[model samples]
Target chain A: TQLLEQSPQFLSIQEGENLTVYCNSSSVFSSLQWYRQEPGEGPVLLVTVVTGGEVKKLKRLTFQFGDARKDSSLHITAAQPGDTGLYLCAGRANPGGSQGNLIFGKGTKLSVKP
Target chain B: DAGVTQSPTHLIKTRGQQVTLRCSPKSGHDTVSWYQQALGQGPQFIFQYYEEEERQRGNFPDRFSGHQFPNYSSELNVNALLLGDSALYLCASSFTGTGYGYTFGSGTRLTVV
Candidate 1:
């Protein structure tokens, strides 16, 4: 079974601080997706990275896929209180093995206090 | 367009009882997948349905079963549930060949007593 390991299980920071969360794995994936989930709601997709060494930025958040596709990271710049939530990383295996199933990381819970 | 939708929003059931959860895929989506998320844990894949058939399943037990309809909606049925079965059950929908992200529903919170 494939497993994704995420770091910094919990994080707390003041507003305007920067934080980075990491997700690592031994298995390579066809693509990796990042999601942010608020309390009492399902996860919402933030971004998807499909290539090695790929970097995608959305406003204050920057996401990077490892060169080997076995790891990824999410960095939030000038974090605000609204950025507080649980961040999850999910990996889709290469096709033909098990299609449409996403292996997920335990996730990092971030709390940004004003 | 509306994203994935799941009902009922919350349920309470006794141990050993059977429960069925339903999901309607997003517009233009043809695949539906189920997941279980325990408090403070990531969601675990339960299974995926396509073309009214279960195409893939996770390591869950036989007590966990599902069915898909022609309209791409799906139902997850759990029999003889245990307290451990209590969790947030999420439904996600995606197109068959789209490598994009899957759209997730708000999820049904199942509490097994």
Candidate 2:
């Protein structure tokens, strides 16, 4: 079974629409990371949120870590065609003085139509 | 400096044939991790190597083995490859520091016929 699950496996929307992808898990994590991948490249780290209930904004993207540290969300405002790609969520448990290994979600495929 | 890089961008092999994949971590990083990703799915961790020694490993079978060099580059060898082993192999590098930022390579695509 997938330790972390992403919702709405696929999403397609017109330009300028708002969208949000959810990542949920039963296990608590010290940090959750968000990444975006193009067609042929590997996943690139977008941001890392350490504290629970933390919210970070990356231009049109807003990332929030759940208060319980067991879930996270990615909201994009005014998504453009350039945003079309696979968005992934990864979690790292026992962050503070431990080894860094990430558990990934299945990922949400998104498409923005112009 | 360049980011993490993997070799043999794409390869095709038949069943029972062994294959080797190589990876060179980014500058200033010491830890290396390997993951296997099938189409339309998330990556599954294979193992992690540090100081030329394996520090952690995943649930992969013995068919998957790896070695780390003094320069921090790594090589993954799959013995008695099976058709089920066809997937994209990715190498990620991370420094066990404050950031410990894990940077991934573009990946090497291996197809077993």
Best by lDDT: 1
lDDT of 2 by residue, B1-113 (tens): 99999999999999999999999999988889999988998888899998999888888999999999999999999999998899999999987664845899999999999
Q: Give candidate 2 regions above 4 Å deviation.
A: none
Error of 2 at B19 (Å): 0.8
Clashing pairs in 2: none
Residue pairs of candidate 1 with colliding backbone atoms: none
Candidate 2 docking DockQ: 0.57
Q: What digit string (tens of lDDT, one per residue) describes model 2 on residues A1-114?
A: 338999989999999999999999999988889989887799998999888999999999999999999999999999999999999898887665226567888899999999
Instruction: Give each prediction's DockQ, rounded to 2 decimals.
Output: 0.61, 0.57
Can you tell me the CAPRI class of model 2? medium
Per-candidate TM equals 0.97, 0.97
The weakest ten consecutive residues by lDDT in model 2 chain A span A93-102
